[model samples]
Target: METREKILKAAAEMIADDVTATISVRAVAARAGVSTGSLRFHFPTQRALQDEVLRRIYQHFMPNDPLRDRSLPARDRLVNCLRQMLAPAGVGEDARRAFKAAFAAFIAPDPSEQVHTAYLSYERASAGRITHWLNALDDEGAVPQRDRAKDVRFLLTVLNGLAMERALPYGDSVLQSETDTLYTAVDAILGTAAS
Candidate 1:
């Protein structure tokens, strides 16, 4: 493989293995079997390298994401897209395990700078993806031109709460409640809330 591709691959592998998603330049260079200078030649800064890796990761995972489906109503599409984020949590024992892993990685104790930075990077990427979806809806005139930042925050807050609920004993109505909450949030953000 070429030098640039090799470096990127090594970095991506490191991120995949790391619970905090931390990427160290020297570590990547060592893994790629290249010198730091060579790695620097392709990616001038750490942030640039991280951004490129995240962009590629998102593209690979979301190539045919539901958010791109124009056939569905805007609200439905948005709600479905949000639901996809929670699908990995499953339910019952699965959800509990997922929550346990997350807590151990991010919430059990004080997080290091690397852990904190990695968390922030992921958070920013998620917010960026949500904003992109909102922008697409706005372009289609399906959503109002409001403060999209606030809307993104609102949706993320709801998603976080719903994810936590999945791990708890919510009884048989959990799925229906989640769906209703998503639809209501989508409606509010799109300015189509029922009277």
Candidate 2:
């Protein structure tokens, strides 16, 4: 692999392996098997290096901007997309574990600029997707005319709460409860009954 890519992958793997990883330049250099001079040459600054790594970290959880898919019913599509905001990136147990690990790092208290960058990126991406779906719903007259800004904020707030709740107990029942709660809130917001 290329030197710069190696360094980036090394840093990303560090966070994936240990959410508490320091990711200091020296440490990343050693991990990547590159010299500090080479790492600096590619990264310019630690902040820059971290920023790139953060982008990769967020990539695992953020779904393909679901706003682009229009094949299904708008409500179904919107709900599917919203669910994807917190849903596993793939199927089965490993996907869930990977998502949990990635998100744990995202949510863990970290004062680093990299964490801030990753957190804000997630917010911006998810918020943009939410706004797009809301606009589509409003256009279809499914949602009553109102402050879209407020609705977007409210919907995302609820979804973020659900996403954060995953850090709690792990089990089929716990996941089902979370899913039930999420759909309940979403149905209330979008006016659909589960039954």
User: Once all C-alphas are superposed, what RMSD does model 2 give against the true structure?
Assistant: 11.6
- Candidate 1 segments exceeding 4 Å error: 1-60
lDDT of 1 by residue, 1-195 (tens): 999999889988986776355677888899999999998999988856765676566678789778678887888899998998888888878989988988887788698986787678768767766776776677689998888889999999998888889999878999999999999999999977544
Q: For residues 22-70, could you state the per-residue lDDT of candidate 2 as single tens digits?
A: 5799999999999999999999988678656765554555456454466
Candidate 1 CA-lDDT value: 0.83
Worst 10 residues of 1 by lDDT: 15-24
**Per-model TM values vs. the true structure:** 0.68, 0.49
Badly placed stretches (over 4 Å) of model 2 are: 1-74, 89-114
